[model samples]
Target: MNIFNRFIVTALLVLFTSKAFATSPIITKIERINVNTILVTFDQGIKPVSHFDVPIEGEFSVKLYTSTTYYLGSPNSLIVRTPTAVNPNDNGFATQWQWEEPTLTATDNDGLSEITINLNAYHSDFENDIGHSSLDYINTLNLIWQHDLSITSINTLDTNEGTNLEHTLIASDTAATFSIIENTSGLFSLSGANNATLSFDGTNTDYESTTKSYTVKIKATTGNDTNENTEQTLTVNIKDVTDTAPVIRRFTISQGVNQGRLIIKTDTSVTVYAEASGGSSYTWSSSDFSVIGSGAFVTFIPNADVGTRTIKLKVTIGDYSSERVLKLKLVESHPTDWKDKNNNGINDSKEIGRHNNELLVGENKKITSPINTRLLLGIMSEDTAHLTLAQMKKYRTDNNLSDNTEDTLTTGDIYNYVVENFSATATTQVIIELTSPIPANAILRKYSPATGWANFVINDNNIQSKTSNTCTDDTHWQTGLTTGATCLKLTIKDGSENDTDGDQNNGKGQVNGVVESTISIAIPAASNSNNNNNSGGGCVYNPNAPARFDMGFILLMTLSAYYLIRRRRCFNH
Candidate 1:
């Protein structure tokens, strides 16, 4: 145990301790630049654990200093390494490798002692950068962005007034916004709202066309207006909806038209149509339900109670509607032979009543007036029908007519008195059967001295026609009457079609023109019974006789009847 042996052991121990300190590197401080980048500062210099030149960028790992256990960065972030400036010695020991990483921006003064490293500049080539590490990076920290964002067009936006459209814009900054820059027409409004809300304002469809789109340019910033920013595209879409209101231009009556008014008759169907713009639906109604209409290009029907009516039609298009009105009326009809002298559709002779009102037939409603004497008389008579008995006397005195002492002036009495006093001829009606049945809409009419071209009720649907010749008691009139001899012109027309009343000859038929077969009628006739004989009183009257022979057999019948009675009495005795 000499002093020389103890010195050898001490020297070996000192050598081992120095080697241990050189191999280990201690990291002291780290500064975060952003989410994926940091600056790592170290307390001592470090030498790379390994160095290799790779042909391709692939999976590999490296450490700043060789150690049995510790690593400074995430292993997943390391892939490959670059060759160092100071290569390892033959014994795998070297002071450090040359630091030359483009991302690893650092400064070194005293070799391997201290350095500034930027982790954002960290690539596999930055390994063993051979520079001293320190805390200088804490003074300079900045954010850099490399992310991209954009916008897509929005389609098929809808609204009742037009097209209202909205587009969702996405970005990486704290907020999103849009501004119109690429739009040439300036027709679009790009609103930049800042609440990170789902919808934006200042954009509407009212001013835009239905099928057009506009583009916008926008600048997005990250948190602040710093150098970190991105440029994006924006699209705005707008559409047009139905906006036109309906308009009624013209009105048409489908049937029962007389003058400007609808002449509703017995037929169940009568329609009114309004030619309009943008009409999709229709609503029809009458002042009274007696005439009701339904649907677009509506149809209407009359009820049994006859009078004037106003029919209304409403048409709609989109959100707007329009209405139109028309006037209609129902007038009483007479048989083909009744005379309505003034075309009033009322028998002229029936207008001779005393009225509750002061109107008289021959005065204001003058009997000689050319306009419409029959209509005036009908109005006068109808007015007086409701009068009290006391009022009738005063009306008679005002008109210079006979006073009626009866309790009331009935319609029958007024008409009968006028007929008896007037020179107009009353008709003797006969039923003339036809082969075909007339349509319900068919019109039965007659134009003769007894009737001035008016409507009639065709009994049994075209089976009978009234005659002009008056008759009484005699049911059978011999069938050999000449053409036009009776002067009774009858007609049947389908008024629903284009048939017109041109004077009285439109569909006229005379005594010879009518009568497909012999027939009889029950309508009462005027006086002068058995008047069918143009051969004067020669048509012998016999209460009952054979089809041919007349009163000439009456004498022989009388004589035979007397003999039969006598023979019966004698046989009984």
Candidate 2:
């Protein structure tokens, strides 16, 4: 049992152990490219052998090779040998082999299987340090055999625009490395190594309009097939959301060249419109539903009354809506061709009747049709006999003017007198009245057909009780009005800096500022006040009168006293 026997046994044990743990060649391809062609692959090289002379039934010879020159490390440098039927060659290895078997057909072996080859030691670990000892070993290398390996796919995706595309639901083989072979839409992408995932980047640009579809060609590979690769198309369907709103560009009839203040004449019609970008429509209405109708160019007839009215419009596009309102007014027709403006079967009678007894020529013809209050008015005279009853009656009779001044002189009576005779000279009293309290700071003015508006003055005194809405100013012949100033006007004048210089007329200005009411002036039988301010026989101009300048008189008195003082000094000398 000596050292010699122990050495022999230990050497045999090491040899067998190295052969058992040697690396096996990897099987990469096992699928038939066609019915007659079989493809095979391995991680290492096969030793090549020549074709044999003897053919066994339907079988032909297999080729093999060994590659030993360029690899490194323990498993990196291992070698391969064929099944015992084929022999290994000297300096070559072959993963590509040609083998014909009587039992093999494309129909019978349709999926994954393997081929077994023997693996031998590194050239550095060669037995007896020889290069040809690989044929003696029984250690085998198993590779993917020539019977099937392939990949399938899911082939479709659905997503929304502006959404991230990470689709893990694409069904594919786990053994493959996935790639996008064609992506015309620039939406499909890939990531990861073995069995990659499909990614999509859907932006607004990715979808041109509302809904769209895209196609991408994807391929999965194991680096095993050499002749051709299989590719599939992935259909991407993009989705869109709907829009829901409408807009109205114009809501009121406040447009066009001839319109003023949203007000139209009786029996007149107007149109309204709205707009929307997303193919929208509109429906028209009124506060009084019977007045307006629906359309792009809907027309509305204003009510046959002088009052405010409201019109409404509703606009819609898809599921959205907007509404608008129009506030408008209606008024009576022109006086020459008057219509039943109030729709009450009355033609201009109520409007004309409000002014005392009858309408006056060239007066404000536009009136609200259904007035409830009495329109009171008056006329005063110049500083002479201008509006005397005889003269007024003659003018009225000559011009066909109405003499409805029976109870008291009506607005028509005084109006016609001045319209016929503006040069009749007189001086008189001023009359004014209202239903309620007058607006504060109102005054009376005279309108001369030759000049313009002027202040009315009472050189004698302001008479009458001065009630809330009524006042009477009695004038004297010498200190009141000019000979024949045509019209008289009463209006509110909230005293501005430009109204007057506070003299020549009842502490009032040269202008009335706002018109409240009016009539003509008739001479009143009154005498001048005894005050020195009006005793001189002069024209009492209400504004811009010479009597308003007292500064010149004071200057003249100062000059006269200086001259007298100098003459007295000379006389003393």
Candidate 3:
């Protein structure tokens, strides 16, 4: 070993160590050099013969300085060399490198970082240098990298942008409200979501006076990892919502009687209106409240019960609707024959009664004899006769009469008496005295017999005696004969009577006759001895021929004869 040989070997070893140290980069301390620039220093003590030589050491340390702005790259990383000897000269050598990320240095006065690096300039150089590094060398090197990142933010809205109409309108002066919304597309969140306000500026200055354009500004925040400021402007064009209620001025409907045609008129173009809201078209409804027509104008046909119906007009525009109540007053084509005379709206019994009085002819005719007369006598002919006493009494009992006295006769009782007593024989004449003035065309027939069966022949002027030409006073005599005879008879013929009375006359042979008579006759006594043995013997008088007698005179004679017989019997006793 010569001195020259030793010096050459030592120089080679030193040179190899310095190269190795240069190839292997390490970070011993990290420092903020500036806001935008980062500086790195390496130790030159250990050197490798070539860039591919392997170093005996596993770890190394270096110093790193950072700025606010820096480029993140691989070429700037330092690593150990591999596949090379300790000799200074080696052709096949490889070097390994790693990246060292640096921290940003913030300025004291301002929160912003002042130093920055041209990332685009150093990006390719750094990738080419450190990307070919070995695993062990790259892992042993300590290096720092830095990069600048950016965040984007946006604002969003949860509600839609439109006007909200709350009230229905009848006139055109109604006001509407609109809400301004910010649409963020779900990218960001608003700071005061509910407190965001909308300012309006337009022709309608009463709402807002800033004429620049209506807009809604939103204050928003983004992700929590980054401080981001976001804002969005919502262009608000407050369209006329027609929120002003449609003026339905002078809405009226004229209808004819019996559900005739109804003509409707309104001051507005939308003639038909209703109670419902939000219909672009109007639905004209009838009494049933059905949609008959869907348009601006409509015609409604009423039903039978809906004579004069009050139709409701409903008109809807967009989300808002309006209604105008119109009256469809009916007009009568002709006056009703029966009206509510009692002033009540309904045609009740009292109204019907009044109408009957006005329209019916025999409504006023009633019986006068009884206290409360309601009986009406309608005589068809003049040859009518009075009833017998027994028949009259039977009729009264059958008709629920309380007593047999003739003084208290109800209208019904009087009518029954007249009907039962009178015989429809001939054209009988009758005179009626009414309790009140009779209505027109009333028929009355009632009479009293003053003489012999009251033989009457219905004449045009009065009822006269058929056989007797006696001048009978018939003024107070409703119907009676003036002549006295055994029997009274009435004759009726189908011929017009040309007499003194102004009574209606019809055809001939329609008259009937009734007879009343009294005669003196004898009835034979019973011839049985057993019946005679029960009574004492008395003389029985028998008449030889029929003889007419006065009933009063016969009655007197019979009473006198009985008295004389009694007196004689008393004397014998």
Candidate 4:
């Protein structure tokens, strides 16, 4: 061997070792810069030779860094892009880069020997930094809303209050909360889960004269992250409803007399009713609380004073109201047809028991003795009579009384009565006194279970009347019997003296015999004739016979007048 050959071999070995050491890159640190990017810092300036080798899982680019010259004469960093979003939980990612990656290669600026880094020296540090990749979102994280947050429904509601509107919001984050950002007139509020409710407070409902609609702005957010929230505006409309006024129909009195004007005595309470429509509430008021009560039906009680009282009733519906006033008269005493001859307030004849059995007729069109001990009389229509006819027949049948075969009594208000505690003998008598004279068109009849209905027989001499006469003093003889003849007097002569009923006890009173009498006053329909049939008395009391006789007389008169006119014309010719 030659000395030159050994020296050359030693020199070649030293040169190759120096070149390998110079090309190797020493990594100082490895870190993640973004969700898809990684940064590696070296001990010296470096240049790219081969792209980074990454796991083939998704779309990726291997040419993350490509340079022919050093960066600023000393490139010490390398930036690598990931195939996809890096999963912070993947601990084997650095393992792949230290062992599986092979294509990634780099060299010095002189392009000497190629070198490949193991990357295992930076495994712990790189993995720790990659686990916090979500922190890279500090600069570019954005919120994405899912829906438009618009409500699409008929928002108009009637002026009637208590209406609701609902709307839902969707955000990329499910933990978002909705809130009302701006409310017009403070009329709208948000509530319920997720603040999905949009409610309107019904304070004012007048749409025609006030604001008709409202607007509000809503926002959805998660905590204080304003960048990840959304906002929307909502509107609600109102509709107007027509308002109508209430009406009062009529007023009626349940007690006292209603002769165009109401008349009542002290200690008498009359129930007054105000019939109305289209109202929501009823209120009654009076200056004197003691004289009237409240509501649609009020009790009017007269005090110990004689005069008039005013009561008012008001019906209200919403904003509309109607009112009515009533004037009632109060009296101190009852009306009677007796005379106070001794200057005392009491009737002298009444004190002596002469008029004790007499009954004063009331405006209810009824007259009766105390507790119906003697008589009960009332005036009613044919319909009312029919309603009571069944009861009357039942009573007769139950009491074993004779059957009624009488013709039906018709026209006017039928006056019915039962006489009790009276004798059927000629020694007993009854008198029917009226406030006004009996009309000439009226006729009196008696209905008996045994004899049916017939003209009531009476003594004309005992009859009395009063026509258009006023009694100022107690001695005027009430009914003006001296002025006309409106008072009818009935006398009983045998057991059959107008004994129309066979009750024996006469309803609920003292019983004098095994049989009693019932009286009825009936008027002939559309007739003004007097009946001539009589039983024992001379008084003729037929109300239907006059029409036929008058018609015949009228025909004869008309013919006679025609004949006279023709004869007179012939003589003139």
Candidate 5:
């Protein structure tokens, strides 16, 4: 145990202890340069390695560099570049860099020796720093965490013209809310929980009349964070429905003039036009007769075929076509020839009928058909040369056959007549006189081939005074008719007339140039009231029927006024 031997042994022990336990690199601070980058500082200088790994839950790369250029607290620092940005809402993460003192082939400066750095090695003490040599150590690292919202699964979509479109909105956050921020077309809406559902508005779209496409901007937001919101634009396209059936509507152009019902006359041409929807082309044809032209419109002349014939129209679009058939008739035009079997100043054959027990004269005539049917007709024309009643048919809806003041009644009937060759410039007039007194509210309604029905207003301004006439104002006579005449006279302008068969006129099409007219009467109910028992049997025309003022109503109104006056007086007293 000498002094020299003890000193040497103590020195050796100290040297061995110093070599066995050595201080490792200590991480000091972490700073976030941007959302995708971070700066990491350590207590000691770390070797500049090409590649390394940090215990973090994302994809990133690290660069070891000198710290004096950036004045980061240590001589060794790391610059982390994360192409995938971090979620700001992740709070703080437990991340560290660890290495074992096993196999690192360190070479001299500018040496070509290969360096191996174990980056993914597992260690037990991850939560706490493991103090070791500078070449092998674990250092804790801190990063700024963030949240980012993203919109996904939204793209261009397509739907049929008349159908609705629906799509589920997808976002980075499950609790995110979606809203339509920009929609100029007003055809889209966001609904359902959190507004996560996008849908088309409930409106039927027409391919022919509506906009073809729509563009809208949608935004996704969460947690009341403006920075966490995202926006995207979506497009919706409308597809046409080619299989939709075509619809056909019928119309007629008469004499190359005004549009009206179909005209069927011998040697006179009329045009039939078919207006069809969803049709690219139209073919007008007929098996019974040859059509004059082709396509949407076709003109035809009856010639001598004076009966019903079928006209067919075929509409085609792409590979589909639809056919519709229409029935039309042709009638021969006749000239006016009324014979005077019994000689008189007036034309005898032109007489429609006579007044009760009297013969008509001058322009007045009587219709003497069907036995005991009395009708007086008056014609006022400068030249009645070519005028003729080309056709006349009676519909069994009405009847009025009785002498003066007879109580005979009948349901209303329609009288259709086709007047031919009348002077188109000079207006012709007809005066119809019935012997029996009609109901007070009776009206004469006229029918046109184009428009269905209208009231035939009587013209009293141009009424002609009759000599030796038995009609009177009391009998509902025209103003200048006979004062004591017991008949009702009506004067109206003629309307262009037409009456086709049932198959044609069943609300599909109508023939032009045939005048259809009817008289409607409101028969008085059987009542013992004094108004019904008036001197003329309620046959006067009353435009406004005033309300009756019975004795009870007058007394009640008087009492009500008296009560109001009494109440005012009491209040004043």
Candidate 6:
């Protein structure tokens, strides 16, 4: 326990601690190229130091320069040693060593000599080889190096270990090879990556009917390396052929009337027939037709007497049958009557029998009672004098009248009594039933062939006269006539020639006579009463005139006063 013993022990403990816990050589700069290659340079200089009382050189050695190599095992290792001997010419000299396994080897054993060696290590295409060769090694004595390393061995490793490597080579040719046997179903598919099923039939001749395309991939592995075998899909297009036959449906027949004519008064019944294919023979039946047959023809007759008639024609074709109906009609003929004798549906009798006796008789028959008598008188006068007695008798017979009736008169009687025996200066009277009131200006005209004269006289006075044979003053003849009142009269006057002397006769002559007869004028119910304003004499009466006075005298006095007043006013003004 003395101080000397303490000094000696402490010195020994310091020496032992220095040897046991030596300072590690710092890697000042370490550059790694890819995953496999690394370059290291030291910063501190080498100094001779003692360990365990032995002389040791300040040499640096790279003991564990670990990297990955494809041909080596896990964590493939590299060890580098540099000698401590200095070159005789330099005082502060550092050694630098570059190493590549199997390419270069170190000769100095002192671990301080400068050495360069090439290691056949794995290299990536992106690594710089020149930078890996120039690295400085300083006083790095026996540097126990530790580094993160990757191993890419030639032998196959587990999936977890090989997944970290950047490059792996696979035995692509020795791996499984897949070829498309057949794409039975025409669809796109991949092998290994995706399996597809095809629906194509191999036995069919149209093997390439549809294009069959597939991807073929090969897999190969050598130890831990893997290679991909890729191939573009091959498309096999199958060609098709025409082998089926064309099909057609059978032909069918339907019967109908092309054109038919039917009489309006007679019955028209027609039969429709039809025929079709797909049968050896056809049996025909119809509800209307009495006859039945086993041929292709079937007929259906319909009873069409009036209006339209339809008959259906049916034909059977194998198990199927079709039907068609035809339409026909029977129209009534045109009617025939007294007005439409031609029967062309038009009343042409009126145009054909214009002015005939039947037409005249029909018009004359329409007149009632007293008018009928007047019309018969007028017609009989024209016919009796111009026709013989037998002719007049025949005319009466045709009109459904007795020839010996009291109304019947002979032509000789009309000529001798009404025309000859009656004086040309004499006048006869005949009464007419009245249906309306007579108009003021109404006149009567009578024809007298015996005297070669016609007379027209006003019908106002009961006593007839042989006036002038003109109707100049009769413009208002239709005025003042009322319904249900006697309205018209006729006065037949003799001419200058007399049947007695056959020449002009004066006052004592048998000519210049008058035949007086009465006629009834019918006023239609729809006629207006104010239309009686028509005046015949062209004279207007003064409003101040007395109502009891004659209209003719008032009109004259008014005209005279108007003239005198106009003259006086002219003088005064």
CA RMSD of all predictions: 28.1, 29.4, 38.7, 29.1, 26.7, 46.8
TM-score, prediction 4: 0.23
lDDT by residue for model 5 over 1-573, one digit each (tens)? 999999999999998887677455555644443333444444543322222363443322233222222212123543233232222123222333222211112122323222221111122112223332232323333232445787876578888888888989898788788898899988889889989889986257777776787888999988677767989898888888875445443334444432333234655676776656557887877876667767778887655355445677777788866555554534353224423322121344444553222334223432121222212211211112111122111111111212221112222223322221121211233333343334443444434333434444445443332333444323333453343333433333323221221233343222211112333222323322333545454433334446676898799999999999999999999
Clashes of 4: 8
**Which parts of model 2 are misplaced by more than 4 Å?**
1-244, 251-263, 289-294, 333-573
**Could you give candidate 6's per-residue lDDT for residues 104-176 as a string of tens digits?**
1221122322222223212111112111212334232222233322222132211221111122322223333
Candidate 5 lands at a TM-score of 0.27
Backbone atom clashes (below 3 Å) for every candidate: 13, 32, 72, 8, 24, 45
Q: Distance (Å) between predicted and true CA of 236, model 6?
A: 99
How far out, in Å, is residue 238 in model 5?
A: 11
Q: What lDDT does each candidate get? A: 0.36, 0.39, 0.30, 0.44, 0.44, 0.31
lDDT of 1 by residue, 68-144 (tens): 22133443343233433234446433333332233323211112222223232223322223332222121232323
- lDDT score at residue 288, model 2, on the 0-100 scale: 50
TM-score to true structure, per model? 0.24, 0.22, 0.19, 0.23, 0.27, 0.15
Which 10 residues in a row give candidate 3 its minimum summed lDDT? 514-523
- Global lDDT of model 6: 0.31
Q: Candidate 4: lDDT over CA atoms?
A: 0.44
TM-score of 2: 0.22
TM-score of 1: 0.24
Ranking by TM-score: 5, 1, 4, 2, 3, 6
| Candidate 4 structure quality by residue, lDDT tens digits, 229-335 | 67767666666442544545445554543321234565556677766655678888887535454667777665534444557777788897755555454445535
Model 1: residues with Cα > 4 Å off, grouped in runs? 1-149, 153-166, 170-245, 249-264, 271-283, 288-297, 304-309, 315-321, 327-573
